[model samples]
Target: MNHRHLGRSGLMVSEIAYGNWLTHGSQVEKEAALACVRAALEEGITTFDTADVYAATRAEEVLGEALAGERRAGLEICTKVYWPTGPGPNDRGLSRKHVFESIHGSLRRLRTDYVDLYQAHRYDYATPLEETMLAFADLVRQGKALYVGVSEWRAEQIEAAAPLARELKIPFVSNQPQYSMLWRVIEDQVIPASERAGLGQIVWSPIAQGVLTGKYRTGQPLPVGSRAAHEDGARFIAKFLTDDLLGRVQQLQPIAQEAGLTMAQLAIAWVLQNRSVSAAIVGATRPEQVRENVKAAGVKLDDGLMRRIDEVLGEAVVRDPARTASPEKRP
Candidate 1:
C-alpha cells in the first residue's frame, strides 16, 4: 500500500487505512476480523484506525490481538476519544480528566505503550477547548500519544483550536471526517481551514456507507445482510438510500467500468484524488473486501474523469459547508 504524510507532520500512514469501526467486535466474528486484519497486513497496509467507543471498546481489543506480533515501529495505530465509553459522566467528552482517563483505557485495550495518533472524536460543546488541548499536550509530553487530531469538527472549531495547540506545542496533525462521492460537506470550508492550520484529512466512509458499491440497486430489496440491512449500520446509511440518490449512484456504473474499477474502488479513488486527503479508512467484514479496497490506494483519476463524475452525481452531492458539524450538546 502507498503511504502519505499526515498533514504537515512527518508521520506517514497507509493510503488506505484498515479500520474496524463496525465489524470487529459487533458485526463480524472474532476469527473473521482477524483474517481481515491479516489480509490488510499482507496487502502492505501499516496504518490501522479505531476508536475507544467503537463496539463499546471491543474493536480496539480485537485489533490489538490481531496485530499482537507485528513489528510495532512500522505500524501507525490511531484511536479517538469524546464519545460515551461508559455510563459515568466523566467517561465522555474531552475534558482534561476524561482525556487522560480515556488514553489510559485505550492503551490497555490496544496493548500499546503509545498510539501514533490520538484524536478527538467530536468537538465537545460541554468542555472548554483549553481543557481539551491542555490534556492532549500532556499526553504528548508523557509520550502516550505521538500526534493529536480531531474528527467531525467544523472549520471554525479547527481554526479556533489551531493556535492553542501551537501554543501548547502539540503536533495537531489530522482531521477525520466522513467523506465520499456523495458527501462533499468538508470540501468547501473544512478542507481550506485545515490546510491553513497544517492538518490533513483521514477520511472515513469513502464508499458512502457501502452505497457507492452499487450493491444496493434502486427499488431492489435491501441487499441481504448489507450495511443498510444491519441494525447497527442502517441509520447512518439511511439518508443515502433514497431512490433519487441510489439512481444517481447507479449512473456511476459506466464510469467505474470505463475506469476499470469496481464502484467501490472508484469511490475510494475519487476521495484520494484530493491532495489534502492523507488516507481513506475502510472497514470490512471479510478478507476479500480488505484486498479489494487496498487497490484504490495508489489509483489516480484524471481531471476529465473527475468532471464526468461531478456531472453524473450532480444534485446528489452534499456540499453545504454548514453540514460539517458536531452536536451542540455533548451526547
Candidate 2:
C-alpha cells in the first residue's frame, strides 16, 4: 500500500484505511469481522480507524482482538472521542474529564499503550474550546496519544481551533469528514480551511454508504442484504436512497467498465482523486470486499473520467458548505 503524509505533518498513513464503524460489533459476527481485518492486513493496509462510540464501545475490543498479534509499530491505530458511551452526563463531549477518561478506556480496550491518532468525533458546542484543546494537549504530553484531529468539524470551527492547537504545541494534523462522489460538502470550505491549518482529510463514506457501488437500482426494492435493508444501518444511508439519486448512480457503470474497475473500486478511486485527501476509510463485512476496495489506493482517474462522473452525477451531488454542520446538542 502506498502511504501519504497526513496534511503537512510528518506522519504517514496507508492510502486506503480499514475502518470498523458499523461492521465489527453490530452488523457482522465476530469471526466475520476478524476475517475482514485479516484481509486488510493481507492487502497491506496499515491504517485502522475506529471510534469509542462504535457499537457502544465493543468495536474497539473486537478490533483489538483482531489485531492482537501484529507489531504495533507498523500500524496506525486511530479512534475518536466526543460521543456518549455511557449514561452519565459527562460521558459524552470533549470536556477535560471525558477526554482524559475516554483515552484510558480506549487504550484498555484497544490493548495498546498509545494510539497514533485520537479525534474529536464531532465538535463540542457545550464545552469551552480551550478545555477540549487542553485535554488533547495533555494526551500528547502524557504519551497516550501521538496526534490529535477532529471529525465533521466545519471550516470556521477548524479555523478557530488551529491557532490554539499550535499555541498548545499539539500535533493537530487531520480532520475526518464524510466525503464521496455524491457528497461534495467538504470541497468548498473545509478543504481550503484545513489546507491552511495543515490538516489532511481522513474521509469516511467514500462510497456514499454503498450507493456508488451500483447495487441499489433506481426502480428495484432495497437489496435484501444491503445496508438499507437493516434497521440501524438504514438510517445512516437513508438520505441517498431516492430514486433520482439511484438513477444518477447507475450512470457510473459505463465509467467503471471503461476504467477496468469494479463500481466499488471506482467509487473509492473517485475520493482519492483529491490531493488533500490523505486516506479514504472503508468498512467491510467480508474479506473479499476489503480486497476489492483497496485496489483504488494507487489507481488514478483520468481527466475525462472525472468530468464524466461530474456530468453523470449532475444536480444529484451535494456541495453545500452549510451542510458541514455539527449538532447543537449531543445525541
Error of 2 at 107 (Å): 0.5
Candidate 2 RMSD to the correct structure: 1.1
lDDT for model 2 comes to 0.95
- Clash pairs, candidate 2, are none
Put down candidate 2 lDDT per residue, 196-220, tens digits, no spaces: 9999999999999999999998778
Q: In angstroms, how far off is 14's CA in candidate 1?
A: 0.7
> Candidate 1: deviation at residue 329, Å?
2.3
What's the CA error at residue 72 for candidate 1, in Å?
0.4
Q: Give per-model TM-scores.
A: 0.99, 0.99
lDDT of 1 by residue, 65-140 (tens): 9999999999999999999999999999999989999999999999999999999999998999999999999999
